[model samples]
Target: MSSSDHPNISGSSQPLLHQKGKEIQEFGTVNQVPLGLSYDARLYACQRLNRVLADTRMLYSLYKKHHWLMRGATFYQLHLLLDKHADEQLALVDVLAERVQALGGVAVGDPRHVAELTSIPRPPDGVEEVPAMLSRLLSAHEAILIDARDAAARVAALGDDGTNDLLVSQVVRTGETQVWFLAEHLVDTPLVRL
Candidate 1:
């Protein structure tokens, strides 16, 4: 006649905790959380790693699309530029994915997930014009590199040794290189300034 009479709540139907325990036993225990840091630190590292991985994917796709569609103004140079940019981005994808796995989180592979999670903006529609495409591409890559640096700093500050090491030794260096390459294109160079 009372709520206590309910089997589910009163343990008559086996407590929810017990049921969950049984289910976990049947499914096998989940991965153990890594030690050596506060929960806040670990959570911060995971989120930072996720941010970098998603941004890597978004930037890679933009480079590839722009490579194929780019036209006008220094056509050969821009063509080669986009292609090389795509290659650089492709290399970063592997590093970011590995970092995500090392941190105990799944790397985002689905384009939908990348789009949903990435802070970077999508390339504007029908942006086949070369200078315009180059401008957008530069901005996108710069934004991505900045996020990578920020995430690296966050992970380092949280004392995630592995992520910090990876970030310092490779990720940040490559990102800076790519950013430099993209930025250099925008500088005005005189044909005859001698």
Candidate 2:
């Protein structure tokens, strides 16, 4: 019945549960690739992927925030759409992080780290009007698309075909499609009239 009698309690004889390890690699650095690509190419691809990863993470967060805060006559539709977009963005986040690791670079996993790397403007912490929220999402999508297009082109020039393909096929395509969907919601066309 005493505190000292508890088996899991930490004491002079009990040790902590976790072990610490030395840092193996630093962020923003990549090791040489044996997969027929030069060190410079892998390094460049990793750098580009990390940037995309950071922005995708921020976009995903925005989607989730808007999903929960969705309102008005379009609440049901917008809620589902935001959640779907968030899921897609989450998938891209995984792909991007894996691509970074494949290149022997550390992915920016920490949100604080991501915030520092992301170019997407931060939204208001509190909820805004649905139009403002949708606009915010549209802007974030455009920012990612612009960066992805440029990065894809540059990586292709660097002979990083895999990274280039992913940026174009996944990141760029997904962002463009999402932008289209979000933009349509902002059109002033009346649902019941012209």
Candidate 3:
């Protein structure tokens, strides 16, 4: 190796690797952000938003799962619907995470962490009956809608309109629409009346 081989290289240039450091910002804490929100408001919004983010991720995973395992006469329709819902949930996941970051708080990103924080129950490993799978989805959506409605109201009371709008406009509305779709699938309507 010649010294002139690399013009910008200093003697013994090695990349810094395997670096470890203490946590800069712990979970459940917020930084000092001048976004016109008080500390309590920011912290409260972060806490609520992170919970919703976790559940949204879980719901996305569930949608993917059910979509893959979907079977029967409605399989074709369900496969597409579940996938569409999953994509929307994934988008919400990003939006929720960014909202948390914007509030100067850490967004829960790890699957393991999300599993811990999510209120949604885990479905069985094996496929359930199609009705059961749809029921599970409806249940998850209901859980999220319940929390979202409460959180939206509380955050609005705290004077955090952005978070309130996100919870109500995006989370609550999407959840309600999806639940309506899923619930209809369980209806005992005859395609051809006798």
Candidate 4:
């Protein structure tokens, strides 16, 4: 067929029209799932996951701040370590957010939203000493670990196996490891004399 014979197919190559759809789901609500869990279970899981997500996001921010503000004899080491932990926490943030969404809940995206959701205490705006910074990081990690452990147990009891697995395998494990590393930095052991 000649180009003119296919007028419908060659209609100036314009893009297809689109329209914005109305919001179908609210932030605090969940859609039905066939995972065999009760509505109460999914709702509870999402609430717990959202809390973890908030704290994880805050922890990631602390890591970045400490990474930039690092200063001491171990500056290079701590700087690199904090950046690495930040990246790890960032990964956990994504996992937690996705888990919340999979449970049909909206993940908090804004920093202000996270601040409102998170229970982690806000740190000073300016730079803190190296020990103080490391201590702060450890404290954040512990807070997350404690919550994840409790949530995992409760979610598992509620028959939300997926959330339980995520809390135990990813969130708790990562937080515990990071806590160990940060806590070691605060040890008073002498490098050479002791």
Best by lDDT: 3
The stretch of ten residues in a row with the least summed lDDT in candidate 2 is 7-16
TM-score of 2: 0.90
User: Model 1, range 2-65, lDDT digits (tens) per residue?
Assistant: 6667756554654556443332221111234666666666656666766777787777788878
Model 1 segments more than 4 A misplaced? 1-30, 33-40
Q: Kindly report which residue stretches of model 2 are placed more than 4 angstroms away from their true locations once superposed.
A: 1-16
- Single out the weakest 10-residue window by summed lDDT for candidate 1: 21-30
Pairs of residues at least 3 apart in sequence or in different chains that clash in candidate 2: none
Please give the CA lDDT of all the candidate structures: 0.70, 0.92, 0.94, 0.89
Put down candidate 3 lDDT per residue, 44-116, tens digits, no spaces.
Answer: 9999999999999999999999999999999999999999999989989999999999999999999999999
- Candidate 1 shows a clash count of 0
Say which candidate scores most in TM-score: 3
Give the per-residue lDDT digits (tens) of candidate 2, residues 39-70.
Answer: 88888888988999999999999999999999
Candidate 3, superposed: residue stretches over 4 Å from native: 1-17
Q: Is candidate 3 or candidate 4 better by TM-score?
A: 3
Model 3's TM-score against the true structure: 0.92
Q: For residues 59-109, could you state the per-residue lDDT of candidate 4 as single tens digits?
A: 999999999999979999999999999999999999999988888778888
